[model samples]
Target: MMRIALIGTGNLAIHLVHAFETCNATQLVQWVGRSNTPPKQARDTPYFTQYQNNMDTDVCIVAVADDAIPAVAKELQHIDALVAHSAGAVSIGELEPINRRGVFYPLQSFKKNAPLDWKSTPICIEANHGDDVILLEKLASQLSGSVHQITESQRLQLHTAAVFTNNFCNHLLGIGQSITTKAALPFSLLHPIIRDTFEQSFASQAVALQTGPAKRNDIRTQQKHLSVLSEADAELYRILSKSIFNTHNT
Candidate 1:
């Protein structure tokens, strides 16, 4: 079994701990955090508040914050085992002092205390050497069926796209919920429509499936929507309406 040491106590680290528990080929040897308070989920695993240069492990995963990754990598440079970070946008070169360095980025937003299906998650990996790449891929494949070798630049682009697809869309859903609540209507009423929109988006271009006052350039209906919204919501509505109109009309 491949012994692994994880260095972080954040959401991603929690998810990784759970994933490792499910993988028979891997054993989580240690979990390093800033405090001695062991992660609630990793109660049985060994915990360390400081980096131990002598810890023997097949792989050491640095799952810290993006900005802290470089410092963590530099600190763990003395270790002989392969060191990898879990940042999508951070380059592998951040681990400059370490000869054996790699990236094992999981392309999904992690929430604390939430259960995740590791099998369906996509893992993006990169390494300084070809053999290290193979080793990283082998380890990632145990947790995810879709393991991709993506460059740092490509990973950054993917992360940007994810913000648009996931974050931005979720924000819009929140706005929709607020509108429904203000109108004293159940937000559940929008569930079917939201589900249909996603289902249709997969079958064709989103622009082609668009059907709203903005898509039809119905200024009267747009003005009606703006009249009912608060100042902030009205401004947002105006901007989105104009964008939708311009996208299809211009």
Candidate 2:
């Protein structure tokens, strides 16, 4: 079995450890971290808190904060193990001078309280060598069927798209919830609409599935929605609606 060293004890690392442990072809040998540590409940095997002791593993996966990745690479410069990081924005060049480097980015939002099926998550991988890419693909195939080779530019584009789809969309939902709550209506009323929005897109292309006053160019209803929202929310609604309309038209 190929030995693995997991660096960092964050949410991503936790899920990865669970997935790797269950994969028969790989052995999750060590977890390296600084003062931060995964909770006792998360510990299924031995883990080390120092970098020096982490050198024994065959592969080193740096699943730390994006800012810390360079430092991790510098600290482990002497070691020849394959080094990889879980960053979407940072390019493979960040791991330069390391004999073996690759990207093992899992494209998904994670919450510690939520249970995840690793099989459902798509893994985005890239490497300098065909062999390295194949190695990553084989390892990622153990957890997920959706694995793809993406260039650094493509990965950055995907990351930016995720911010709009996930983060910005969630903020819009929060605004909707707050508006409903302040009007003495249950936020649950929005649930059906939100659910259908996501569900329909899964069955059809999101652009083809678009619907709303803005999508139809129904200026009258759009004005009514703007009047109902507070100053900040109204501004946000107008900007997003304009952007959506522009996007659909173009």
Q: What is the C-alpha lDDT of each candidate?
A: 0.89, 0.83
How much lDDT does candidate 1 score?
0.89
- Which tens-of-lDDT digit does each residue in 11-125 have in candidate 2? 8987888888889988888777775655563567667776655346666789999988888888777776778899999988888778788999999997766888888899999
Model 2 / residue 92 / CA error / Å: 0.7
Q: How close is candidate 2 to the true structure, as a TM-score?
A: 0.90
Model 1, residue 49: distance off in Å is 0.8
Find the 10 residues in a row with the least total lDDT in model 2. Answer: 35-44
Q: How accurate is candidate 2 locally (lDDT)?
A: 0.83
Question: How far out, in Å, is residue 114 in model 1?
Answer: 1.7
TM-score of each: 0.94, 0.90
Please list the Cα RMSD from the true structure of every candidate, rounded to 1 decimal place: 1.5, 2.1
Error of 1 at 187 (Å): 0.8
Clashes of 2: 0
